[model samples]
Target: MSEAGKANKARSGGRSGGRAARRTLRTTRDFRMLPGLTRNIPYCEVMDEAHVERLDNASMNILENVGVHFRDPIALEDWKTAGAKVVGERVFLDRGLVRELIRTIPAEFTYHARNPANNVRLGGPHSIFVPMTGAPFLRDLDNVRRNPMLEDLATFHKLAHMLPALHSTAHHIVEPYDHPISQRHLRITYSSMMHSDKMFMGMTTSPKNAEDVMEMCAILFGEDYLEDHPVTTGNCNGNSPLVWDETMLGAMRAFCRRNQPVLCSPFVLGGANTPASVPAAVAQLNAEALSALAYTQVIRKGCPAIYGHYLSTVSMRSGAPMAGTPEIGLMNFMIGQMARHYGVPWRTSGSLGGAKTFDAQAGYESASTLSAVIHAGANYIWHAAGWNEAGMHCSIAKFVVDAVQCAMAHRLGEGPKWDDFDQALSAVPDVGPGGHYLGHPHTQENFQSAFFMPELFDNNSIEQWVADGEKEITERALNHARNLLSEYQQPMLDVARDEALRDYIARREREIPAASELNQSY
Candidate 1:
C-alpha cells in the first residue's frame, strides 16, 4: 500500500471508534438542569469611576431635590419614620440614609428550590436565567399566536423544567385569559410549583395575591423553613418617573416581612418615563431602585432585595418601545456598575426583542440583549427566553433557541478551562507539520466538553441537511421543544404537601371574586 493509504487504514479504526463513543455519549446524555452560572469573567463596565460617581451624585440629587412620590400612605409613613423628609406623598431622601439602608442588603443569598439540586445562589458573581414572564400572548408550537390558557402556562413550566439551561420557570410565562383574573394568580402559582421544583417568582398583582403566593410557598416548604431560607421572589415594578404606588408597596411589604426577596424593578420607557439621554435615564432609574431597596429595609431590617429594572427606549417616530437598542445595552452596563457600587445584587431583562416573528430581526435583537445582560454581570436575568414582540408574546421556538443561547452564555461566563491544558498541548507534537488532530487521542477525549454543541442549531453539510428535510431554525426549535415536553416529568412532591397546596388554591379560588364580578382592566 502507498504511505498515504497505509496512514488512512491505520487511522480508520480509531476514527470509527471515536464516532461510536460520541454517538453513545449523545444518546445517553443526562439532561439535569444547571444549578446556576458562576461568572469567572470580569464584568463589562461602561462608566469609569468618575462617570459612575457622577451618575451616583446625579441620582442622589434627584432623590434629595425632586424626591420620589410614595403614593401609598403606608410607604410615606415608613419613609418618614426611617428619617426621610416626607412632604405629603413625596419623600426626600438624604444620600447618607440611602447608603445606610442599602448596607443591610446581603451581597449574596441562597435561593432555595424544592429540589435541593436546583437551589441557586443569587448575587455576587452568580447568575441565574429566568424565563420571560407576564406575556399576555403565546406563539404555540404550531406557530399560532393566541391568548394562552392555563394548560399553555403549565406546558411552558414543563418545558422550562426539561431545558437544562434555564434556572427558573418564572411565574406567568403567559397570561391565562381563560381563567378568572382574580383567581389566575393561584392557578399560576400552583402550576409553577407542581411542574418545576426550581426557585421561582410569586404574583405581585395585589397584596392579597402576594400573601396567597407566600402562603402556598409556606405549604410547599414549611413556614418555619421559609422564614430563614429565601424561596420565591416578588417583582414590585415601580411606576416610572419616581413614584411607588400602594399596589406595589403593599406587595413589597408582604414579601419583605416574610424575609423573602423582592425585585424592586422600575418599568421604564426612556424619553417617556425619564430623560431621553441614557445617563439621565439611568440616574432617575437608580434613584427609583434605591428608594425601593430602602423600603425593603423599612419593611423589615436586613430583608433580601434585588436592584432591578426593565428599561427600554422609545421610538421617536411611533412612540413604541424599542428593545436591544445600543442605549439599552449601555444602560445595562451602567446599572451593573451602580448596583455593585451600592453592594447589592441586581436584575435586568435579557433576550428582549421587538420583532413580531422569530426571524432575523428577532435573533439579532435577542442576541444583542442577552449578550449585554451577561456582560453586565446581572445576577437575575429575567426575560432570558421567549421574549418577543416588545414583550407582548412568548414564542415556543424562540424559548428553545434562547435557552440554548443561555447555555452557551453560561459556558462563556465560566471562562477558560485549564484542567487538560497539558494533555491538549501534548497533541500538537503527536500530529506533526501539515497533520490534523482529528484522530488524536486528546481530541477524541475532549471533543464533547471542548465546544458548545447547540441542540437547536444545525451545523452539517448541505447534502446532510437536505437529507434531513432542510428545516429552518424555528421549525427545528419547535420540534425540539415538542420532544422536551414529551420527556418532561413532573418534579416529585410529597403527597400531603401537594394536597395542601391544592386545597389552599381551591379555597382562595372560592374566596376571591370572579373576574366577571369585578373590573376587567386587571
Candidate 2:
C-alpha cells in the first residue's frame, strides 16, 4: 500500500476501535456540568473597571430615580417595609439598601433533583446547561412543524433523560394544546417526574400553579427536606419598561417563601421595550433584574436568586427580534461581568437561532451565541438546545446536534491538561526526526480524550465523503434522535413515590374542569 493509504487506514481503524470501546458512553455518560475554562486563562471581557462602575451607577440611578412599578399590593407593601419609597404602585429603592441586600445573596447553592444523582450546583466555577423551556410548536423528523400535542411534551422529557448533554428537562418543553388550561401545570410536572429525574423549572403562570408544582415536589422529597433544600426553580420574568405584573410576582413570592430559587429575568427587545443602545439596554436589564431579585430576598432573606439576562435587538426593517447577533454577543459579555461584580450567579441563554429549519443558519447562529455566553461565564444556560425559528419552535434534529456541541464545549472549557507533561515529553524523544508518532506511547495514551468526538458531524476525507452519498448533518442527526428514542429506558422511580405523584395529579384533575368546561368558563 502507498504511504498515504497506510496513514488513512491507521486513522480510520483506530477511531473506529475507540468508538466500539466507548459505545456505552452515550447511554451512561453523566457529565452534568459543562465546566468553563480554567480561571488562570483570561476569558472574553468587554468592560473594564471604569466601564463597570459607570454601568453599575447607571443601573442604580434607574432604581433610585425612575424606580420600578409593582402592581401587586402585597409586593408594594413588602418593598415599603424594606425601606423603599412607595409612590402608589411604583417603588423607588435606596441604592445603599439595595447594595446591602444584594450582598446577602450566596455565592453558590445546590439545586437538588428528584434523582439525587442528577442534582446540580449553580454559581461557583461550574457552568450548567438546561433545555429550551417554553416553545409553542414542535418539529419532528417528518419535517412538519405544528403545535405540540401532549405526547410531544413527554417525548422531550424522555429525550432529556437519555441524552446526558442536558442537565435538566425544562418545564413546558413545549406547551400541550391538547391539555386543559387550568390543569396544564399538573400534567407538565407529572410528565417531567415520569420521564426525567433531573432538576427542572416550576410553573410561573400563577401562584396556584407554582404551589401545585411544589406540592408535587414535596410528595417526591418529603416536605421537610424540600423546605431546607431547593429542588426546582421558577422563572420570574419582569415586564419591560420597569414593571412587575401581578402573576409573575405571585409566582416569585410562592417560590421564594419556600426557599426555592427563582430566576429574575427581563425580556427586552431593543428599539421596542428598551432603548436602541446596548449600554442603556443593559442598565435597564440590571435595574429590572435587581428589583425583582431584591423582592425575593425581602420575601425571605438568603433565598437563592440568579441574575438572568435575556436581551435581543429588534430588526430595523421588519421589527422582528433577532438572536445570536454580534450586538447580542457584545451585550452578553458585559452582563456577565456585572453579574460577577455583584457576587451573584448569572443565568444566560444558548443554542438560540432565528432559522425556521435545522440547517446552516441554525448551526452558525446557535453555536456562536452558545459559545459566546459560555466563555463569558454564564452559570445557568436555558434554551441550550432544540431552539429554532427565534424560539418559536423546537426541533429534535437540532436537539441532537446541540447535545454533541454541549459536550464538546465542556471539554474545551476544561482548557489544556498538562497532568502527564513529563510522560508526554519522554515520548517525544522516543520518536526521532522524520518519523511519525502514530505509534508513540503518548499518542496512544491521550488519543481517546485528545479530540472532541462528533456525535452527528461527519469528518471524512473528500473521497470518503463522496462514497458515503454526502448526507447533510441534519439527516444524520435525525437518525441519532430516532435511535435515542428507540433505545431509551426510563430511570426507575420508587413505586410509592410514583404512586403519591399519581394520586396528587388525580386529585388535582378532579378539581380542574374538563376541556369543554374550560372553554365555556373562559
Candidate 3:
C-alpha cells in the first residue's frame, strides 16, 4: 500500500474516547472522496449540426486565411518546417494540417496522482472538479478581504484536499502575495505537494519554473515514473486576439516535452478580446485553441492536451467582465459542441460570480454558471469553488458552499439511475394509489441512496432553525470548513524524497533572481 493509504487507514482505525470524542469522530467522517465521475447523460447542445459545421468552417477560415501570431521564434520555425506559411511571426496553417495534427492527440488520458487511488481520467465521459486559481485576494474566515499570505494558500490547499467533491488541488488557489514573485511558484508547488496527494497543476509562470516543477515531480513520483505517466498539468492561456506569446509557448514546450498534459486555453473577454457576438467570439477562441493544441503536437506528437477557454461577457455600460451571464452559458454550450466535434476533451470555468460577499447575488450567479457547465458536458471543471468578485477574491465561506454545490452537480452529471426502476415501482404497488410510501419496504431498503441529501443546506422548520440559533448558510459553511480543517491529516510522503524536494527548493531559491530583478510578471 502507499504511505498515504496506510496513514489514512490508521487514522480511520483510531479508538473512540468519550461522548465529545465520539461527536468529533462522527462530524469528521465526511472524508469519502468520490472518484472522477463518468457521465451517462447526453450532452446539451445549443447548436444544430449545420450550425456546428458553420462554426468549424469559420474557425478553419480564420486559421487558413487570417492566420495566428506565433510570437516565439522556435514556434515560428517549427511551423515553417512543417510547411505552414510563416510570415515573420504570423503562421498561416492549412486546414488539412491542423486537422491531421490534432488527430494524433489521445481522446482520453489518465492523470496519475501520488496515491494511485486518486488518479483521474480526463476525456471521453469522465469529469473532475478543480478549485479556483489565480485569485490575488482572499475573503478570509473572518470575512475580511485582504491580500493572501503563504499561510492562506496552504489553508485552501488543505480545504481542497478534504473536500470530497474537489478532485484536484489546482496550484495557487490564491496568489501568495506576501511571497516574492520570483520564488512564489516554488512555495506554491511545495504546498500543493505536501497538503494533498491528488493530481495538481504545475507552475507555468516561466519555463525555468516549469522545469523546476517537473524536477520536483520526478523526486516525488520518481524520474522513471514521470517518463511514462503524466502526473501534473500545465495551463497555457493564449494572449487572445489570435496570438500565442513566447511566455505561454515556452511553458507549453516545457510540459509537452516532458509528456505532460497542457491546457491550451484562451482568456476571452467578449468585445474586448474578440468580436462581441457570441458565435464570432467562439470561432476566434476555437481557432486560437486549435493553434495551440496543434503546436503541442508539434512540440511532441501524441502529447496529451485539453481544449479550454475562460469565457466571460463584458458589460458595455460598466466595462467590467460579467460572470454567470446568459452569454457566458451560451458560449460554454457552443465550446463543448466544438470540442466534441473535434473529438477532444474540453474544460470550462465553474461557479464564478462577481459578488463581493457570499450573499444572494453570489449564490444566484454561481448556481447559474454551475448548472450551465454541468449540462454543457465540460470534462474538466476549473474554478469549481471560492470564486467571487469577478475573480478578484477567493472567499472561505463561499468556498465551502461552492464545494457542496459541486457535489450536487456531480450527482446531476451522473444522470438518473434507471436500474432500480422496477424496485422503485414495487413501492407503488405496496402503497395504494392514494397511500404514502414512507413505510414501504422498498423505501426502507433504498431511501438513503434514492435522494441526494446535502449536508450543508438547511431545510428545517423556522422554529427549529431559530431555536438552533438561526445561523445563515455562510455561517454554517464556515463552521463546516473549521470542522474539516480540525480533522485534516497530512498525507504521507517518503522521508528521503521530502527532504530532496525541500533541498531542491532551497537551492533554486538561491539561484533564481529576486522579484525586483525579474523582468516578467508571473
lDDT of residue 397 for candidate 3: 94
Which scores higher on TM-score, 1 or 2?
1
Model 1 alpha-carbon miss at residue 1, Å? 30
User: Rank by lDDT, descending?
Assistant: 1, 3, 2
Q: Give the residue spans of candidate 1 off by over 4 A.
A: 1-21, 516-522
Evaluated at residue 235, the lDDT of candidate 3 is 94
Q: Write the per-residue lDDT of candidate 1 for residues 216-282, one digit (tens) a residue.
A: 9999999998889999999999999999998899999989999999999999999999998999999
Between prediction 1 and prediction 2, the one with superior lDDT is 1
Q: Which candidate tops TM-score?
A: 1
Residue pairs in collision within model 3: none
How do the residues 30-135 of candidate 2 rate in per-residue lDDT, one tens digit apiece?
A: 4343333232234688999999999999999999999999999999888878999999999998889888888878778887887777777788666678889789
How accurate locally is residue 269 in candidate 3, as Cα lDDT from 0 to 100? 94
Candidate 3 per-residue lDDT, tens place, 1-522, comes to: 999776555444432322223243343265657789888888889999999999999999999999999999989999988889999899999999999999988899899998898999989899999999999899988888999999999999999999999998999989998878889889999999999998899989887778888889989998888767999989999988999988889988989998998899999999999998999999999999999999999999998899989888889999999888999999999999999999899999999999989999999999999999988999999999999999999999999889989999989989999988987887776777545554556755665567887888986557869998999998998888888888899999889999999999999888877764363443
lDDT of candidate 1 at residue 111, scale 0 to 100: 95
Write down the worst ten-residue block by lDDT for model 2.
Answer: 31-40
- Where model 3 places Cα greater than 4 Å from the true spot, the runs are 1-28, 516-522
